[model samples]
Target: MGACPCGTGRDYDDCCGPLHAGVPAADAQALMRSRYSAYVREDADYLLRSWHRSTRPHALAFDEPRPAWLRLEVLRHVATGPDSAEVEFVARYRIGGGSVVRMRERSRFLREDGNWFYLDAVGG
Candidate 1:
């Protein structure tokens, strides 16, 4: 089995595949991890679905020269309220043979109707 992109030391199917397949994430952190996996897979549909409706973009273009996602390091997760949370993470990726790019962000999430959706990054 292939390893998960989220660096959770788990297989893809056991980690984020179910979430990508329409099973709701258990919490904000889980949703964040699943979203990272979506990016790795270039699954724009899953990305849009996991994004908050109000802030979701109309489309995503995963054209050629796509970054090869390396791994995800979750730094911290905090529950701001019963239905809101934040997750700090660092995702590493590389485009073609270029140096790896590390993207660090503290992202917010909102839970509605028993589902968690990414809102946006705090300052990133």
Candidate 2:
């Protein structure tokens, strides 16, 4: 099996695969990593399902010429509250024949019941 797209250096099945297969993530960080893996796999359904209803869009659509996601570097993961957390990461990608672009964001997540959901970007 190939390495997981989340840069975990582990087989997909051992890493993000189970999360994609309907298993609940153990923590907010796992959910964040799985969300990145979902983007790499182009799994819009999983993304939407994992998103907080308050900020989730009606749908998710990849750009016409999808960007080639290269790598992910998680810079920080902090538990802001008993049921809230934030993860800051840098993701590099390249659009059709374009130079790689590095995008960074600090995303917030909240746990409702026992499932973690992505809330929104913390800051620009």
The per-candidate count of clashes, in order, stands at 0, 0
| lDDT of candidate 2 over 4-78, digit per residue (tens) | 999989999999999999999999889999999999999999999999999999999987889899999999999
The whole-model lDDT of each prediction reads 0.94, 0.94
Cα displacement (Å) at residue 124, model 2: 5.4
Output the worst ten-in-a-row residue range by lDDT, candidate 1: 1-10
Candidate 1 lDDT tens digits, 1-124: 5998888889999999999999999999999999998898889999999999989999998989889999889999999999999999999999999999999999999999999999999864
Clashing pairs in 1: none
Q: What is the TM-score of each candidate against the true structure?
A: 0.95, 0.96
